[model samples]
Target chain A: MKYEILEHTADLKIKAYGKSLEELFMNAARGLMSVMYEEESSKEGKEVSDVVLETSGPDKEALLVNWLSDILLESDTRNVYCFDFSIHTINEQKISSTMKCIKSVAKEDVKAITYHGLTIKKHNGKLEATILVDV
Target chain B: MFSKEILQKVQKNIWEIPKSYREDMCVPARVFASERMLDDITTDRSLEQLVNVSTLPGIQEFAISMPDIHEGYGFPIGGVAALSVEDGVISPGGVGYDINCGVRLLKSKKTVKDIESSIVDLANQVQRDTPSGVGRGGELVLSQDEMDELLEGGVPWIIKKGYGLEGDEEFLEQGGRFDEADSSLITDHAKKRGRDQVGTLGAGNHFVEVQKVHEVLDDEIAQTFGLFKDQIVVMIHTGSRGLGHQVCTDYLRVMVQAMAKYDITLPDRELASVPFLSKEGQEYFKAMNAAANFGFCNRQVLTHLVRGSWKQIIDKKEDLSILYDVGHNMAKRETHDGKEVVVHRKGATRAFGPGHPEIPKQYQSVGQPVIIPGSMGTFSYVLAGTNESMKQSFGSTCHGAGRRMSRKKAKKVIDYNKLKQELDEYHVVARAGSARGLVEEAPGAYKDIDDVVNVVQETGIAKKVVKLKPLVVVKG
Candidate 1:
């Protein structure tokens, strides 16, 4: 999968294209974490039990926010890295997914998820997601 | 759009964007800015954000932005808007992520000359005593029960614990406590995030600077705040730390649902809000107040820690006291526009006029103290509110030397060693856990605070009391 970061804002932006929903969601989460955490310092660890999330937004932009919000919410609340997620459903208004959290107490933490560059669109027949994380 | 094309000049230093900007907009967007800063910042998304903010339900006559405005999440960093309490909307975006992140100023009887030789020792003491940087915890750890009380009691609780002075509380805005805070509205997770974070100087633009009162512009107001020329003072800039951030994030999820429940339609989802009288809105206010109180309490506790550092570093028996504490990112139920409105000021400080009920009796003749910190190694400001600000910005003023360069950009352009050398030349003793942090916060990365303060002072929004030059800096 490959992604592009849009110009600038306090919140980060990334457009990821992948062959599978799991790959795309994983890349998107990775993109958001890079802004708050020193990505160079992150480590892969023992995987925790799988957790599923389901949320429905009124539109794709809201859907993307809900998707990422669920991942981040899980991280802060659970105190673990939500390393990956596989989307079972991706629609304009709803999503269902199974996510894996790196089950370790983390040294890094995200302060908040910002509403900067928060939008979802399709470009060149590929899904694009841009979101902001407030650290 | 924040296009001045739609704005009508009602008077000097005030511009209005009518309600016609959008159908959902409850009122116009009012801006408090110099013609120059307005022109410079409005070209970006900040103005559009202001207009979007104006569209929030129950927003009063206008949404407003301060002179030191910049693009931010939902509201402009220096944005202010009040919603009719009975009908207006409440938004987490309006208060920002850091919650009650604010500034507290403390004055010392000693002159700058008296402590000139001990600058390094004082800074080292502060860094050692005051918790700072990412993932740091301070000496104060509130149990679940204590945090609940702290949320409601605010600075008074801190003072009770021997953190501040009786005179200090009398001078604080709202006596440094937000009364509406409902502990029930805060989640266990949020309380946990904040529990160990009290007295901490969080990362990013957060700082604690020991400064000297270099100039006093208003003798009466300066005297009211116990500020004197050459007097040494310290400014602690921080907020509810991790807890507030968690609260805002927690509420944003609920707000998104609230928008749909209220059938509120908006151009941006980030502008999600619920009518102020709605259950969700009231809960947000309660929770936000709790967070704001947490922020207030956090600063209060920090004041105590700093006092400890000062007494030990300089002289154990020397007297040290607080001047004023002000919240920057907060929402309050206040009277404005001849009505009760819920005003949300994110990255803007409340500057209530002298006689406002919120200000304590001791400052009835001088208004609230508004401490605007400069970037590291720069001059800080002390301004007093004017009735004009009360009439104009829901009693608010510019918060700080708004950033001109991104931290990433600053780190690239400002060499850490050179910046340190330049600061040393100014006799600004400094200590930081990270050299990278020093570079990211280079004074060159921000607008000249002198310029920002002059505009606010000249506009009569707030009168300058004194200017503070850094004596020593401690970063976290």
Candidate 2:
């Protein structure tokens, strides 16, 4: 499975898995989008817009948080819902990506991405991460 | 990793983990909970988080947690700490991501008997008049200049704009404005996020509820606050929406990077902070205050909306006055024990006792009004600050019932139809924008608010005044 929801007392948690780092990041974004758009109606009646984003962090965890934060910022300020993500290049310190944004409404407002008990690990030749989102 | 043996029982309802429990702890950590409540607290990392909070520099007295404490990012929810302003540090996590997320109570002239038949209509009207749910914008969008004024002037500016009633500011905490707010310190991105969100209630636990005073625990104090058994009141629970979240996110990054420069090391990166006197700290304080102003005005607009909704079914001239408004997540500079300290109340309420100059003159003989909302469909409470709270808890008390079960668990265990039927049994109406949201906030998800309030009262931090039962709930 690409992603699964975990139980949290006061927030939402998602566990994502992928065969590669890029896939892991992509799956995490998809998981967040799923939480934010729980209703199918939010996905209808919107034209897609192309957008490119570039950011770098000291490590992979920071990079993941930065990437998600950028998505949240764009979704709130630009009034667009992200439907898809494509990672062109990713390294230890930098990542470049293109995301497809659609004109849709959200069903939930994810306040911020938290770092509490945040970790990314590899097992059985696969990358996995458990991320918590403050709703 | 916390063992029960590490805690020393201080009293029937108090427990303490001495400074020696952790080598780096600068002060002892204390928790107020009954035996039953302590078991729930021990199921999570709240105690360990409290120990981590104790390690912060210049933390005076004790790092404390209320009975309702639960696991959070850094400091646990229902946490309290007082840091000496002269030598202390300010952590953004202490004030939480939602700056000034608070509750406001409005008392009406009508009683439950008068509004018994119209509860459903009132709930429907409130849900329609108030813009709610995710990505929903309100009718009152602000220009950049007007937004700046709101960030600084708070409810006063909103009142001048013909949104709220005049003299309403008198009933708010800090008169609904913080003098130190600096709009220039607020980022443009934050401004953009807030421009359309004012007067809107965002999703996930934010709500507007019509409540009835079912019981009066302290008649004298209830009378002083204009509350009587069977009176109908309105409660609004929300905060500085996206603007506050962005402000915290922006400052957390700054503080995380500044930690190394200041030669500071913490057990967790989420506890990133700077000395209160530092430039970065001052900038964060100013920006935080600005976001808090946004929260204050946000509630005021909702108050106006509630008043309008009430007018639709009741008399147009009927009075629905604000009893009190308090910010549960905040850091305020106050004088404690004759020393200047910045008290951080994450998921706690300020319960300053009688005669405190910060309260309104009319309430000086009593104490600051404290509103504690229960889980959806449960019993909420009204309490007053006490002198013992000022002495023991830095003038703070518990905020709510606190979560006992996770939202995911609630969704799994609770049948939505059955829950709706249960509310029907209580003569309560529940309205929501999403079905999943309602299940997530099921009454079974939280601890019993009565138990939480009893601990606070027994501990002498706050005294009970009244108990309110929800008659109608409108969720975002």
Docking quality band of candidate 1, CAPRI definitions: acceptable
Alpha-carbon shift of residue B312 in model 2 (angstroms): 1.3
TM-score per prediction, in order, is 0.92, 0.97
Residue A7, candidate 1: Cα error in Å is 5.5
DockQ values of all predictions: 0.37, 0.69
Q: Residue B247 error for model 2, in Å?
A: 0.8
Writing each residue's lDDT as its tens digit, candidate 2 over B1-476 gives 46877889998899999999889999999999998877788888889999999999889989999998998888899999999899999999899999999999999989888988887889899999999888888898889999999999999999999878889999999999999999999889889988898998888888999999999999899999999989999999999999999998888877877888888888876777899889999999999999999999999999999899999977688858999999999999999879999999999999999999999887899899999999999999999999999999999999998988888788889999999999899888999998888998888988899999999999999999999999999988
- Candidate 1, residues B183-211, lDDT tens digits: the string is 98998868877778878887777888999
For candidate 1, the lDDT comes to: 0.77
DockQ, structure candidate 1: 0.37
Off by over 4 Å in 1: A1-11, A19-21, A40-60, A73-109, B1-12, B18-24, B161-168
